[model samples]
Target: MKILTITGYKGGCGKSVTAIHVATYLSALGDVVLVDSDPNRTSLSWANRGQLPFTVVDERKAMKVVQGRDFIVIDTPARPDSSDLKELAEGCDLLILPTLPDIVSLEPMLQTAHDLGEANYRALLTIVPPKPSREGEAMREELRSNGVPVFSTMIRRTAGFQKAALAGFPIRDLTGRDRMGWLDYDSLGSEILEAIGR
Candidate 1:
C-alpha cells in the first residue's frame, strides 16, 4: 500500500481538507483509508458525522492497519519539528505539505522539506484566492525557484470547503455552486497518481 502524509507546520493551512479530498478521489481507484493523526481528529469527526464511504482510524494503528488498502492517507497535526517530520514521514510514499499563498506558511513548508532529506515530498498551494492575483503564481514561482517541487494544481479559496467540512462531506458530494470545489482536488489527485505512477 502507498502511504501519503498530508502535513504542514501551521494550522488552518488546509491540510485536513486536502487529505479528505485526496482520499475521497483516490477511493475510485481502490480501497482508501484515512488515518487521522492530528489531535484535533478533524477527519475522524467528519467521518462520524457524514458516515463517509472510506474507513477512518486513529494514528496508533495507522501503519499496521493499512496492510491491505490501496492508499493510506494520513492527516497530520500542525507544527511538527524537523525530527517529528522525519518520524511522521517514515515509510511514506509521498509527503504533501499544504501551504497558503503567503510567506508565513511557505517558510515552514520549505524548512520541513529540507528536514526530510531525500524523501519524496511536494509543496501544494491551498486556500488560494480565486480572484486574479499574482500572489498564487508568485508563490509557485518562489517554491520552484527554491528547488521545492510544487503541485501545479492549487486549491482555490472557497466557502464550499468550510461548508463541506461542517456538513461532514467531501466537496465532491456537495451540490450546486459549492460543488465547484471538486475540480481542483480532482486535478491534484490525478497529478499525484501520475507522479507515483499509480
Candidate 2:
C-alpha cells in the first residue's frame, strides 16, 4: 500500500480538502482509506456526515488498518514539529505538500521541505485564482527555482470547495456550478498515480 500524507507547516492550505478529494478519486482505482491525523478531526467529521465512499479513521488505528489497503491518504495537523514531521515521513511513499500561491505559504513550505531531508515529496499549488492569473505559475516557478519539485496541476480557489465540505460531498460529486472543481483534483490524482507508477 502507498501511504500518501497531505501536510504543510501552515494551516488553511487545503490539506484536508485535498486529502478527501484525492482519496475519493483514488477510490475508483482501488481500496482507499483516509486517516485523519489532525486533532480537529475535520476530515473524519466530513466523512461521518457526508457518507463518503471510502472509510475514514483516526490516526490511532491508521497504520494497523491500512495494512492491506491500496492507498492511505493522511490529513496531517498544521505546523508539525521537526521530530513529528520526521516520524510522519517514515514509510510514506509520497508527501503531498499543498500550499497557497503566496509568500506566507511558500516560505513555510520551503522550510518544511528542507527539514524532511530528501524524502519523496511534491508541492502542489492550491487556492489559485480562477481568472488565470500569473500568480500560480509564478509560485510554481519560485518553488522549482528553490529546488522543490512542484505539480503542474493547481487547485483553483472556488466556493465549490467550501460547498463540498459543508455538504459532506466530494467535489466530484457536486453538480451545476460547483462541479468544475473536480477537474483540478482529477488532474492531480492522475499526475500522482503516474508519478508513482501505480
Candidate 3:
C-alpha cells in the first residue's frame, strides 16, 4: 500500500481540504482508506456528510486499520509535534505539505519538511490568487531556491472551493476541466502518485 500523509504545523493552510480531495481522486483509481488523524475531525466531518465511498479511521487507530489497504491518506491535525509527525511520516511513501505562497505559510512548511528529514516529500502551493500580483512569481522562486521541491500545479484561491466544501463534494466535479481554481492540486495528485511510483 502507498501511504500519503498531509501534514502541516499551522492551521488554515488547506491541510484537511487537500486530504479529502486527494483521497477522493485516489479512490477513483483504486481502493482508498481516508484516515482523519486530525483531532479536529475536519476531514471526517466532510466525509461523513458527503458519504464518501472510502472508509474513515480515527487518528488513534489509523496504523492498524491501514494494514491491508491499497492506499492510505492521512489527514493530520494542525499543531502536531515534530516527533508525532515523524511517526506518521514513517508510514507514508510520500509526504504532501500544502501551504500558501505567503511567508506565514512557507515558514511552517519549511520547518515541517526539515523535521521530516529523509522522508520522501513535496510541497503543493495552495491558496494562490488568480491574477499575478507583486508577490507571486518572486515567492515561487524563493520557495525553489530554499531547496523545497514545489509542484508546478497551484490551487488558485476561489469561492468555488468553499461552495464545494459546503455541498460536500469534490471541486473538480463542480469545475470540470477548468480546474475550479485549484490548478496545482488538479495535477498535483498525478505528481504525487508518480513520485511514489504508484
Models 1 onward score TM values of 0.94, 0.94, 0.87
Candidate 2 residue 116 Cα shift, in angstroms, is 2.2
Position 120, candidate 3: lDDT? 84
Q: Model 3 over residues 1-198: C-alpha lDDT tens digits?
A: 888889877788788888887887788788888888687898777766666657887877777777778888988787778898788778679888777788777677678777877778888777777684635455667778888777767767778778667767667656664446545565777887788897
Deviation from truth (RMSD, Å), model 2: 1.4
Off by over 4 Å in 1: 61-64
Q: CA lDDT of each candidate? A: 0.88, 0.88, 0.77
Alpha carbon deviation, residue 86, candidate 1 (Å): 2.1
lDDT per residue, candidate 1, 80-156, as tens digits? 88888888777588889999998777777677778987778888999898876778889999989988888999999
Give the Å error, residue 91, model 3: 2.1
Candidate 1, residue 53: the lDDT equals 59
Tens-digit lDDT track for model 2 on 139-165?
999999999988999999989988888
Which of the two candidates, 1 or 3, achieves a greater TM-score against the reference? 1
Residue pairs with clashing backbones, model 1: none
